[model samples]
Target: MAKELSVEDAEKKARELLDRRIASVRTLVTARQRLAELREQVADADREDVRLYNAALNDGWSPDELRKLGLSEPEKKARTRRRAAAKKTAADAPGVDHQEPAPVPAPEPS
Candidate 1:
């Protein structure tokens, strides 16, 4: 047997239930927004990872085919030329010593 409630009690119970439902909906909405923010952050990190990987590929070392003995002649010649130029520059500069001489200490008096 169901107990009959007065009009005022029924209205109050309905208002409380409605308030709880509204709060639950608000919590769900907040959780969904947070999930969306996390997804965007993950997407941004993925984009940056791809960018870094591509940059590394573009600026990285040569392939094995390019490192063969006969195939690397031009690179060797360019490196040699650069080294010669650097040596010439160092030789031409005055008051600049390239060799490391022995360090001399002050003589201690008795």
Candidate 2:
């Protein structure tokens, strides 16, 4: 006859598996929160990168030399206006107030 698992043994096994799952989920949550924070930091760093690149260029550093040093040209920041204004863009709604243009005159016969 086969022996059945003891109650103590079953509790130990369940705790082991559930603990592992909890640890993994905790790690994932921590990583996702850190990833979001890092993204904001990276965006701030990009703006600073552009500023420093421009300063170096103004300091007489040649573009070719900078390229050889592996520092590529930084891109311009996209947000020229305030945050609220930037977010409130034209949402591709249809233009209902349409106006007709004047008709062109036909050429006289030669």
Candidate 3:
């Protein structure tokens, strides 16, 4: 079997490696934040573009004319939403009776 690192040793080694990777790690974090900001701006821009196109169409601008003017139609991004699962109640569950049935009595000897 391969040698395993102890908890303390692992943490120590991890800390040591972090010194080499700290700059790259910081860069990754900054890139992620920048990407998020850009995505928000893109969404806002898409909404604005669609609004402008519709308003222009209402103002008698043709589709051909809009296309010739270098405007591209927005491709919408699909967002997935998660819903919370409903909790089951004891009464709603099967084979879970709240009240007990009456007991049966034995017959006497003749």
Candidate 4:
């Protein structure tokens, strides 16, 4: 059997429980804030990774080489397709000249 609490003792216990609940809520909020910060850091790191990968690609580094260096491959963007489509549309439109310059003939061998 459990001992019965006096009115004062019961009220004190209730206040203690409420205080613990408030502390738990505060800790949860702090944890959430830290999680948000971590997510932002991860996003920033990913951007840097992509930027470096693209730079390496532009510098003639092979995908295999990058992989050997333990770097992740950057995702290909649809921008190239979009740009090609735009160019085609503009060239097909009236008043647009998309002709390539004529190549100069090589000099005859001596």
Q: Pick the candidate with the highest TM-score.
A: 4
Off by over 4 Å in 4: 1-11, 74-110
N/CA/C clash count, model 3: 0
Question: For model 4, how does the per-residue alpha-carbon lDDT over 40-109 read when each residue is reduced to its tens digit?
Answer: 9987887888988889999999999988998759665465443444445666978877798899999999
Residue by residue across 1-110, what tens digits does model 2's lDDT show?
89999999999999999999999999999999999999999999997898899899999998899999998888765767655544433453466435567899999999
Cα miss at 12, model 1 (Å)?
1.2
- Tens digit per residue, CA lDDT, model 3, 1-110: 99988999999999989976998899999999999999999889989988888899899988788889886555666888888888989876999886778888888899
What TM-score does structure 3 among the candidates reach?
0.48
Ranking by TM-score: 4, 1, 3, 2
Instruction: Provide the global lDDT of candidate 3 against the true structure.
Output: 0.86
RMSD of each candidate? 23.6, 13.5, 8.8, 23.6
What alpha-carbon RMSD in Å does predicted model 1 have with respect to the real structure?
Answer: 23.6
lDDT of each: 0.71, 0.87, 0.86, 0.86
Provide TM-scores for the models: 0.49, 0.45, 0.48, 0.53
Clashing pairs in 4: none
Candidate 1 displacement at residue 15 in angstroms: 0.8
lDDT of 1 at 26: 100
Q: Measured by TM-score, how close is model 2 to the native structure?
A: 0.45
Model 4 RMSD vs true structure: 23.6
TM-score of candidate 4 on Cα atoms, chains taken together: 0.53
